[model samples]
Target: MKNDRAPFPRREPSQVTGQRARPQEVLGLFATVITVVVLAVMILAPVARAATSSFVFVGRGNGHGVGMSQWGAWYAAREESKTFAEILAFYYPGTTLQAVKDPDTVLKVRISSTPWKSNTTSFSQVDLKPTVASGTLRKYASNSDSDFTTQTISAGVLVRVQNSGGKVRVTVDDTSVGTFARVDLVPGGSGASEGRNNVQLKTTGGTTVDYREYWGTMRVQPGDDSGELWVYNFVALEKYVRSIAEVDYDWATIGGAAYAPEAVKAQAVASRTYAVAKDGATLADNWADQCYRGYSFEAKYPGIAQAAAATAGQILTYQGEPVTAFFSGHSGGYTTVSAWSGDTALPYLVAKPDPWSLGAPPASMHSQGPGWNWTYTISADNLSKKVNGSLKDTSGRTVNVGRISSVDIVSRDTSDATSHAKTLRLTGAEGTATVSVLSFRSLIGTSNLPSTLILSVNGDVGTGGTDDPGSGGDPGTGGDPGGSGGGPLLPGEFYDVGAGHLYHDQISRVVVAELMGGYEDGLFKPEGTVTRAQFAKIAVSLHNLMNAGDKILVVNVTTKPFDDVAIDSKTTGDTSDWIAAAKKAGLISGTSSSSFSPFVEIQRDQMATMIC
Candidate 1:
């Protein structure tokens, strides 16, 4: 009997010939391994293994971890009597079972109408095999159906639609089912050969599914003509779930069952609404009822939404209510999301590690077909927001750029128009700076259009260029490389509100490099039209960049009597403080003109003045 404590006793190898000790050592090692295994078993006997508390029985197969499990669907069809609709519901759970709602979505089917349309056979007398015996349609077909052959068709098994005049049209269930392609229909058919016979199927959606074909022969037709009438008898090789925009809640499945306060539900609803609305949409429909697309938006797009969300608190506002939401998903499976604050960044963080970690496995709709692989991804929904923040060179100095006061994001998929909304507040002692607006739509091919990054005063949309802050030269010469006519910092150096330095300052090279990268030479244009929101973001960024490991200071923009201005609100950092400082320093004029157009492009002259 092996000793429970002795897993492997050290043993010296035989040194007889200097060669490794042969079979005996090998046997000894093998025995030692076995002894260790047995010892482990013996030692483990005293401590009972923990029993599995529960079995989740996640849906079969893999992929997006939502919708129907392709393999499960197939298995159910083969081993059980469930239909496609039933499979989808079983996997998706709380979803409302409904026909695919998109009109543009199409399902291809194949059918055999050849023998039935020969005219010699009556619809009632003709016996037909299941149509659409192969390809993509096979997934939706009956498990036992087989394709038609010449021997089977020539058997004259049932009602035969004989082509007496070589022309015949077979109508099934009041719809023409088939048509002979040639004018001379099989030697002797009835009408013209090129007309069509059709069959109409009543679907759950109250719409008639029509199957029609022309120029196809019946019976043991030669070379490619056999089984041609079954063009509509497709076996749904693949069922594509159409893309629909929606607001998906991650923890909603827990419901009240989990230990939480009643306010949690309210918060969940509010968050969901806020998220959807940020992209300019609303969530009237239940996301659970829709296909559990999982957290595709957050998982696919990382850093993008969180960055935007963190700034959203100070940027977007509507009717005194701060609104922010995220977006995700493309036509197929590509998805991303926008976050209005850092607090909402968790969803993306957790989902990114494993894309298909949620919901039940998908079911394959048919048997004997390859399983369909579903993919899910999450990313920052409003990338434009981050792009905007990065575009502005937020040196310590104040520019006329409009700072974001609050944020509101909307999901583009939902048409509710007003659900997604979130709020963020900037504090004075925060670690970072900059604000962004998360836009769901993509600017695929419109680079020439002016960018609506943070709204700058002088109309500069993105980063500075040759035109920004104007020419760096003497007033009369108009060609100096340095932007700072006589400011403390160099042309390419950044400046904080109160921080002072000489023309040839000894600032950190990183800040100088950033400024240089932002502009040519070093001319700080003082008369720039930086938007109110952009000024806030740039100020914070510049301060942080210069201090490196040091935190920046900011003051809040005071509440304005203007209907659109809400001063008390804060963002991720001391947004209020910075806004207030800028406002106090005459850097930004509050929204006195009813609305602050933050998206307006900046101008060279305006940039120069703002820098000044």
Candidate 2:
């Protein structure tokens, strides 16, 4: 939102005479009028020109160009007769497909919660009743002031849970029920972790809805800060996967027609693998994780359910452990490595050619999706505003490089037989600054720049120029048709040297190792000691890399190896799991027989020994 208008010139009123104006006076008046008109044109011309000046972004694809492309998978299945396994192999080159033996069949999903931000007086109510499938429902109530208390309710009983003024009140069949900070509903005789129970609820609008048949227990809690109500559902993994497939993929249409069964099946496996790899930390109803709308979504798309059932318990694995199955709407013409997508390079996630996205036969017969190729025209002033707003460097530090004057694509990757920009140089009034392609996309807005597989950036410099307008040219040339100059850094390369050691190549190598494994950011703090928790994560990553392609046994232990690294410890976050895994791998030992000094930092020599 830059103001590109030129300043308007001041105007003087014309002088009039009482009698007929003299010929010289008339001439002078005409000259003055002409001068005024010329001034107006001069003032408005640049504004008009800038208003019309637009940066034409000719690009292809959608979402981050990483892992599997959903559109590509669909095309492959339909045109090349590729099976689900074949499609997965084509995308995740070095990964294997394996079944999870005795995997946790149940998942706890937070379906509905009070809005993160709400007015002080705002409130919400939820009506609940047990379904026929669920027998003898019991409620466990708890609050900040009391322990959990249990009560039994009939299957057909109507229960209303309301939140107001940070207090939760419950009522059954119009009778006042006890108020509590939290409530959990489970099968009468079943433990919290046992049984698949279903519930029916009525919306505030009086619409009846049947939620998913959840396993384990359902928790209803008052929001801690927002004073809102939260409803959590514990559903079976297969059921959750089925619901997510429908939400993530267009079941009714892909390429303007019903999606092929195989395509849907591929989606099912990918979604299932993604959920299974979460290590029980993802919320079932979270869009950041997976979109799960409970039984309503599952019932609406019977086809999705069928697809999930067809691939039940199946997941994409690397070496025997679940692989991080990332998927996107499109790959623009080629798929890229994880590093290009702001992640560390993974052996299974290498860049590769995507013929499906190039529009393979059979699937190509239908109308193309919007993300197949797209163009956007944005004003230069607007572009500068966007760049000045939130551009950042490799170390996640914000960069204020003033108004952008030009943008040059410096470095690109052609390994996948497709060209994509990896580094971009932004020339502004303040100075020229270099940023990753991902950072540029983020600063300009993802919806505007879609993918890094850009064809050309026309009007990147100044107001007007005879730049090649959307030529879909080769990116490796490193030429900005818009008449700009700069060189790009090595693709996927981050960090030049360590902060403390001026010439220590070994420390830089360790930093590189950590970066490659997605452990450290671009900065290499060589003089900085490694914390116990940090070392645990590094050691675990190394262990995984050394045993790549082997089935890793994911241990489910209730007890912590060190009392300080307990599950609920605020300091550990999720690193406790890594600490336990490192101990199991014999990569680290506690300072004492039973205590792991998790907060203590290890010296450089000790870190070298541990790494060795």
Stretches > 4 Å off in candidate 2: 1-53, 112-123, 134-138, 141-147, 164-167, 187-216, 246-257, 338-343, 360-371, 395-397, 413-417, 459-612
Clashes of 2: 5
Judge candidate 2 at residue 527 and give its lDDT. Answer: 19
CA error at residue 512 for candidate 2, angstroms: 51
Give lDDT tens digits, candidate 1, residues 139-175.
1111222521112111111222212232333332344
Q: Which pairs of residues collide in candidate 2?
A: 109-284, 319-549, 319-550, 319-551, 320-551
**Who wins the TM-score comparison?**
2
Cα lDDT of all candidates, in order?
0.25, 0.54
Q: Residue 386, candidate 2: how far off, in angstroms?
A: 2.2
Sliding window of 10 residues with minimal summed lDDT for model 1: 1-10
The candidate 2 region of ten consecutive residues with least summed lDDT is 1-10
For model 2, how does the per-residue alpha-carbon lDDT over 189-305 read when each residue is reduced to its tens digit?
Answer: 344433344545433444444444544466666666554666677666886776763223343344544356677787788888877777787463543455565555566767788
Error of 2 at 436 (Å): 2.5
